[model samples]
Target chain A: MHVFYQPDNKKHFLETDEAHHCIKVLRARPGDELVVTDGRGGVSKGTIVSINPKRVEYQVRDFYQVPLPDYRIHMAICPTRKAERNEWMVEKMTELGVHKIQFVISEHTHRETMKRVLNPERLIRVALSAMKQSQQFHLPEFAYFLNLDTYLGQVEAKERYIAYVASEDIPRHLIQQLSPVRPVEILIGPEGDFSTAEIEAAQAADFKPVSLGDTRLRTETAAVVACHSAVLAQIQ
Target chain B: MHVFYQPDNKKHFLETDEAHHCIKVLRARPGDELVVTDGRGGVSKGTIVSINPKRVEYQVRDFYQVPLPDYRIHMAICPTRKAERNEWMVEKMTELGVHKIQFVISEHTHRETMKRVLNPERLIRVALSAMKQSQQFHLPEFAYFLNLDTYLGQVEAKERYIAYVASEDIPRHLIQQLSPVRPVEILIGPEGDFSTAEIEAAQAADFKPVSLGDTRLRTETAAVVACHSAVLAQIQ
Candidate 1:
C-alpha cells in the first residue's frame, strides 16, 4: 500500500504536494486505500473519499500507533562540500531511524559552500521521501546551526560523541561508548575535519572523541554509519 | 599528501589516469611527495622524479606493509534500479573496507535493468577513488554474477548471511550473528527483496537469514550496514 504523509491525524485530507502526488502522480482515485502517517508515530489506514489535483480527501478506516525508539539519536554534522551528499545523508539517516539532524557549520567547512545555503524545504522533502520509502511512521526533525558552538551549546543528550579521525592509535569506538538506555548525540565534522579548537571545545562539552571504525570515511558516510551504530546499539 | 592507486608497488611510475591526475590536475612538480598503494597490503611513500601528463615517475623513499583486516567481508547485492545508487554503494562499501562486491541478478530484478549491464570499468574506478579517498591500502574487487544461484554456488566464507526483512517480531540481527574471527559474506537484494525460493536456496547453502536492524533500509544502505557490522564485529 502507498503511504502518504499527513501530519494532522484528525484531518481527512493530505497536504497539497502530497495530494498532488496522490491524485496526479499515482493516479489515486476515490475508494483507493492507502496508509497515512502523522510522522509522530501515528499511522492510519484511509480510503480515498474524494481526489483532485489540489486536494485529496480520505476516510479513516483504521488507526494505530507505532512506538518511538527507546533511545533518541541526534547527529550534528557539517554539510559536505557537495549538496547531494548532504541530502543523501539526510535520506539514509532518516531511514536508519535517527530522531533529529542538525546541520552544523564547522571551522573547516568551506565558507563558500555554506553560502550556498542548503534549502530546508529540499531537505525536508528528501527526509519525507525516505521516511515513506522505509515505511517509517516518524520523520526526523531537521535544524541548522550557524556554527558548531551554537550546536554544542543547544543540544542535550545522555551520551555524546564527536567522530574525529585520530592518529594510528585507536580511540574509543562509537559502539563501545554508546549507552543503549540513554539518549545519544554524535558530532560529525566536514571533509577537512574538526580543527583542534573545535575538538577541544566539544571535549569540554563532554562529547567524547570516538572513531566510527578503522577506515577513513567521508563526512556523509560517517554520519550514516554513526546513525546506524546508534540504532544497532539499541537492539540489545 | 595525495594518495594514488598503483597496484604494482615495485613500479616507479603510476598508470595513465592517475598520472594525468597527478601531473595535469594537481600540477605536481618534481620533488613532490605522494603515497601509493598496491591495493593488497603494500603502501609506499615516493618522491616525484619526473612528471608528464600520461606518465608520472617517482623514486620510492619508503616501503611498508599494512596488515590485512583479521576478517573479510564479501557483499553480494543486486544492483538498484538507479545506476548512481549502485555506484554510490560501490564507493561507500569500498570506503567501509568491504573486500569484494558481486552484483547479482535476482528473480525480481527488472529485466530491463539487467540488460543494461553495469560497467565494470566505471565501478573499478569508483572503488579505486574510494580506496584513495579513505586512505586505505586495499581495494575491493568487483564481480558480476548472472543470477543468485551462480553467486551461491561460487562464493565461500566462514560466516554467511542473507539480509532479508521479515515480519514485526525481530529476527536475529547481522551484528548479533557475526563471527569476528571468520570471513563473512552477506547478500542484499534489490528494492524487491529475495524470492522465497532464493532465500531457501541461500539457506541450503548455509547462509543464515539475518536482519541488519529494525528499520527498513534501501539495498545500498543495508549492504553498507552489513559490511560495517562485519568490520565492527572483528574489533574484539
Candidate 2:
C-alpha cells in the first residue's frame, strides 16, 4: 500500500497537492487501499472513498501506532550552500533513524543565513520520501532554523558529542564510552568548521569532543557519518 | 603547495596533461614548490624549471616513499546512473582510505551496459582531488569497467565479503569480526542487487555475507558505508 502524508488527518484530508498525486499521478481510485502517515508516528490504513482531480478523500479503516526508537538522536548541523549536500544528509539521517534534525547557524557557515535559499518544507519532504523508500514507519521531527547558541541551549539529550577536527584525541572509545541506553545529540560543524568560540561554547555545555575518523569530511558527509556511527554504537 | 599527478615522474619530467595544467591552469613559475605523486607509493617535491605549455618541466628536489597500509581494501561496486553518486562514493572512500576501486557489471544492475558516459580520466582526476582534499599523499588505483565474475576471481584477498540483503542464518558480524586481518576485498551489488546465482557463485568461492546496517541504502551510500565500516573495524 502506498503511504501518503497528512499531518492533520483528523481535521482535514490530504490536500490538493497530495490528492493530485494520489488521483492523477498514481491513478488511485475509489476503494484503493493506501496508508497515510501524519509524520508524527501516526499511521492509518485508509480506502479511497472519493477520487477527483482536485480532491481525493479516504476513509480510515485501521490505525496503527508505531513506537519511536527508545534512544532518540537529535542532530544540529551547520547548513552547506550546496543543496544536494544538505538533501543527502537529511535523506541519510532519516534512513538511519534520527529523531530530530535542526539546521543551526554557525560562525563560519558558508551561507550566513538560509532564510531565502532553502525550503525547510522541501527538506521535510525529502526526509519523508527517504522514510518511505527505506520502509521506515516513524518520521523524524524537522526544525527550520536555529542559531548555534539557541540550539545548544534547547538540546535535551542524555549524552551530547560534538565532532571537531582539531581535537587531539581520536575518540577511540566512541562505542564503549557512550551510554547505550541514553539519548544522544551530535553536532556537526560546517565546511570551515566550528569557530573557536563556538567550540568553546559547545565544550562549556558539557559536549564531549568526538572524532568521526582520521580523514577530513565535508559538512554533510560528516553529519551522515556521525549519525550512523552513533546509531551503530547504540545498537551494539 | 599544489599537488600534481605524474605517473612517470622518473622517466619523463612531464605528462602532457600535467604539464598543461601546471603551465596554463596553475601558471606555475620557476622555483615554485609543488608536490607530485606517482599514484603508487612515490611522492616527490619538485620545483618548476620551465613553463612550456605543452611540455612544462619540473626537477624533483626531494623524494619520499609512503608505505601502503597493512590491510588493503578493494571495493568492487556497480556504477550508479547518477554520476554524483559515483563521485561521492569515490570521495568518501578516499577519505576512509581504500587501496583500490573497481567498477563492475552486475546481472541486475540498472545500468546493464557501461556506455562510457563519464571519462575514465575524470574518475582518476576526482580520486586525485579527493586525495589532496583529504590530505592523503597516496592515490588509489582505479579499475574501470570489469565483469563481476572475472573481477571477483582476480582478487586474491585472504578474506572476501559480499554485502547482500538476503534471508539467511548468517550472523551479523561487523568488519571487526575479521580481526587480525590482511588483504580484504568487499563486493557491493548494484541498486537491484546481485542475482541469486551471483551470490551462490561468490559463496562457492568462499565469500562471506555481511550486513552494513539495518536500513536499506542506495548503491553509492552502501559502498561508502562498507568502506568506512571496514576501515574503522580494521583500525580499531
Candidate 3:
C-alpha cells in the first residue's frame, strides 16, 4: 500500500501535497487503495472516492495504531557548517526512528552563535519526507537551533550520553554501557569536539561519556551511529 | 597535527590538491611538520623541503603503517536515484571504516540497468576527503557498479549478511549473530527492497538475513546502518 501524508483526514481528503502527488504525479484515481497517516499514530486504510482538483477524497475503510518505539531516542548534536549534511542526518535519523532532534551550538560548532541562518522549515520538510518514505506513522520532532547550555538545561531523559572519540585509555564504547529499552538522550559534538569545560559540565549534568569507536566520525555520522546503536541495544 | 592526502608522495611532493591546500590554504612553511597519507597503508611524518608552483616538496622523517580494520566490512548496496545521497554514503562509509563499496543492480533497484549513471571518481574524492578529515590512514576501495549475480559470484568473505526490513517472523538482528573481529560482506537493498527471488537467491548462497530495525530505511540509510552494525558487531 502506498503511504500518503494527510495530517488531518477528518474531512476524508488528502493534504495539498498529497493531493498534488495523487492527482498529477501518481495519477492515483478512484478505487485505488491508499494507506494514509496523520503524522501521529493514526494510520488509515482507504480507497480514493474522488480525484478533485482541491483534494483527493477517500473513504476510510480501516484504521490501525502503531505505538511509539519501546525506547525513545532523542538526539541533539552540533550542526555542521554544511547544511546538506545536517539535513541528511535529520532524514536518516527519522528513518532510524529517532524521537527528537535539537540543534546544539557547542563551543566548537561551525557558526558558534545565533548569527547563523538555519532553515527549520527545510529540516521539517526533510523529516516529513523521510517519515513517509520509511512508512513510519509519526514524524520526529525538530527543535530550533539553540546553545549547548540551553539545551542541556532543558533536556530530560532517563539516560543521557555524549559520544566521543575513544583513545586507547577510553574504557567503554557506547555499546558496552547501554541499558536496554529506556528513554535516552545522546549528544554528538562538532568536528573540533566538545571542549574540556563542556565535557565537564555534561558530566555534571549526569551525561556519561560514551565512545562510538576508534575512528573519528563526522558529526552527522556519529549522530546516526549513536541513534542506531541505541536502537540496536533496545533490540538486544 | 593536520592530516593531508598525497596518494603517491613518490617524488617527496604533495599531490597538486594537497600542495595547494598545504601551502596556499594552510600556509605551511619550510620547517613545519606534517602528517600525510598515501591513501593506502603508508603514513609519513615529514618536514617541508621546498614550495614550488605545482607541488610542495617534503622530506620524510618517519613512516608509520596503519593496519586495516580487524574486520573488513565490504558493503554492497543499491544506489539511490539521488546522487547526493549516494555520495553522502560513500563519505560516511569511509569515515566508519568500510573497506569497499559495490553498487549492486538488484531486482527492485531503481534504474536497474544501463540507464543509471554512477561516478566512481566522485565517490573516491569523497573517501579521500573523509579519510583526511577523520585522520585515518587508509582509504576505502570504491568498486564499479555491477549486477547482483556477478557480485554474489565474486565476493569472498568469512561471513555474509543481507540487511532487510523485518516483519512478524523475522528471526534475528545482525548484531545477535555476529562473531567478533571477522571480515564480513553485507548487502543492502534499494528503496523498494529486495525482490523475493533476490532474497531467496541470497539465502541460497548462505547470506544470512538480518534486520536493521522494524522501521523501513532508505537505500543509503540502510547501507550506512548496515556498515556501522557490522563494525559494531566486530567490536563485540
On lDDT, the leading prediction is 1
- lDDT on C-alpha atoms for all candidate structures: 0.85, 0.77, 0.82
Number of the top-ranking candidate, with DockQ as the measure? 3
TM, every model? 0.95, 0.85, 0.94
Residue A57, model 3: lDDT of: 86
Which digits, one per residue and each the tens of the lDDT, describe model 3 over residues A34-148? 9889888889998998888868888999988889977899998888777777888888999898999988888876563423535787888888888988889998987866878
Q: Which window of 10 residues has the lowest lDDT sum in candidate 1 chain B? A: B162-171
Model 2 TM-score, all chains together = 0.85
Per-residue lDDT of candidate 2, residues A85-129 (tens digit): 788889888877888888888877645357644578788788888
In model 2, pairs of residues that clash are none
Q: Write the per-residue lDDT of candidate 3 for residues B161-228, one digit (tens) a residue.
A: 98866344785888888777888989888777778888888878889988877787887888888888
Model 2 chain B worst lDDT run, 10 consecutive residues: B110-119
Off by over 4 Å in 2: A9-33, A46-51, A54-59, A110-113, A168-176, B11-33, B46-60, B110-113, B116-119, B166-176
lDDT measured at residue A120 in model 2 versus the true structure, 0 to 100 = 81
lDDT of 2 by residue, B16-130 (tens): 7777777888877887877888777788887778676577677888999888878888898888777777887888788778889988888865443454443577777888877
DockQ of each: 0.79, 0.49, 0.83
